[model samples]
Target: MNLLDENNRHPTAITDNSAYDGEPTWSPDGRWLAFASNRTGSGEIYITPLEGGVARQITHHPAWDENPSWSPDRDNPRIAFVSSRDGHFAVYVIDLAFVPGAGLPAERRVSPLEYTAFDPSWSADGRTLIFAASLRGHSEIYAIDIDAAPSADGYAMRPLTDGLIDRQQPAWWP
Candidate 1:
């Protein structure tokens, strides 16, 4: 993978891409990067400090995980990514605070089981999460409040768009 400075100039190779590595997301402080790689045979999320530190694997699931989205909360960073652990690709949220040998960090499934979701993006407030999912039909962007109580039928996913218009990777405005 490569890292570029502001204005998208001066590209620098950050990692030796011996394995498939992609979907890089930067921490709020811009000191570290979180990306998915298949270095260990199965796709997993890993974070590497920009200052010559080794990359540490944050996720260790048998199924592949990808598309990591770091939270804007500098105080307590979190990663939201998609995984195929449950047979279908679903979104899961895990804390970015991974101790070198603390084992797998705690994570929770954020999307409903019925639909396959992808491209998780955090809201500016870090209180809501949005992703693209299709329920046996065309994909649509859906948002869910992470801290809000679950609704009667489970997570209250609010659809941001409707009809046949497709959308993916929703971003938040300041």
Candidate 2:
């Protein structure tokens, strides 16, 4: 991964090591960058400081975990990502405020396992997340309120776009 200036000149390498590193997402404070990498085998979430340092692996699962979207709130640091740990693609959120002694952070599946959700984007307030998912035989954008506790089935999600056309990679304005 590389960082480029506003002018798109003098791009600096962020991850110099050899690995499939991509899908970089900057932290709310811009001090750290969260991205997906296959350094340790399957794709997993990793965080590297912008000031330069060794990248820390945040997620450890046999399945693939990619497409990280950091919460916009600095006080409540969280990362919404796409994971296939449950046998199906789904959106999961990890609370970055807590660091466990071992294993990955406690993940909350924001999207149901039945649907394939990816390309998660966070709302400006960090209270909601928008992503693309396959529902009703078509791919469409959806938004879910992450501020509330997950219901019995999972986090409540609603379609943002009609099923008339396929949509992917929903981005929210800063």
Candidate 3:
């Protein structure tokens, strides 16, 4: 899919696939573009040069993986996303540099906090991660401090908004 610049003049394909590609998020450094594509038999996250080239699949799963967001600093090298490889859908995180070309060797499952977690949005500062988690039969927003890695003790997550209604898809404000 092509995305237009703010001036609505410059257009970019973001991906080369003629099949289906969308949800393109540029790398913080502006060198690579990350997006979701189904051209590889199943929907998975693919990264390509911002200038455009053969897209490389970043995820390999029989289940779908979508909503990929890059971290602010390349040094940290992290991509937050949602994957349904497990029986139920959940949130996952993978190291861009740590995972080999074969695709994410092993995705760190971050969901199933209360029920299931999906739609993760990384903080611009890159210290926290906010995502939607289904709890008590309803979806809610939750935030975790990535700076403090989750240990055997467990990471603390708090609801951004407390309510009984459903909430899905979360984006952080700069």
Candidate 4:
């Protein structure tokens, strides 16, 4: 991790290791950073204080877990990321509050199991997630209510944009 100063000069290296870290997202308060790294051989999510500290591993799965999106809600801190832990790529949430030597909190599958989902962006309220998913060979933008009960098909995802176009990342307009 590197921090670029106000003048865009030489970025001060926040991390000085050979671990391939990517997709860094700052917390709502800007006190910490959540990102994915291959330091442990496989992709895993990790959290580190922006002020300089040890990066703590958040996800402990053998499969690839990357693309972390920090929740906007600080009261119920969580991170939404894409993981292939369940056989295929899908959106999953990691509760930060419960991750101190307690293994991982219950895995919360945010995206539908039937689709290959990626790039999860949280709503302002942190109650919803918007991501790109490919189902039936078509890529589309989907918004899912994280707390809503699953439908008969096991997912309550609503499509926001649909087409044959290759849509990968969908972010909410500020």
Question: lDDT per model, in order?
Answer: 0.88, 0.88, 0.78, 0.88
Q: List ranges where model 4 is wrong by over 4 Å.
A: 7-10, 99-103
TM-score of model 1 vs. true structure? 0.89
Encode model 3's per-residue lDDT on 7-104: one tens digit a residue.
86887766555778988787888888788888977879888886757888878778888888887866777778888788667777777777566546
Query: For residues 1-174, could you state the per-residue lDDT of candidate 2 as single tens digits?
Result: 989897858888899878899989889788999999999889999999989899998888899999999999889899999999999899999998876776557678888878988889988999989999995677999899987766667667887888588899899876
Off by over 4 Å in 1: 5-11, 97-102
Model 2, position 103, has a per-residue lDDT of: 55
Q: Each candidate's TM vs. the true structure? A: 0.89, 0.90, 0.85, 0.91
lDDT of 1 by residue, 39-62 (tens): 999999999999877898988899
Error of 3 at 142 (Å): 0.6
State the TM-score for model 3: 0.85
Q: lDDT value for candidate 3?
A: 0.78
Model 2 stretches astray by more than 4 angstroms: 6-8, 101-103
Clash number for each model: 0, 0, 0, 0
Model 4, range 1-174, lDDT digits (tens) per residue? 798888868897767789898899999999999989999999999989988889888888899999999999989898999999989999998887775556666558878778999999999988899999998887899998887898888878899986778887889877
Write down the TM-score for model 4: 0.91
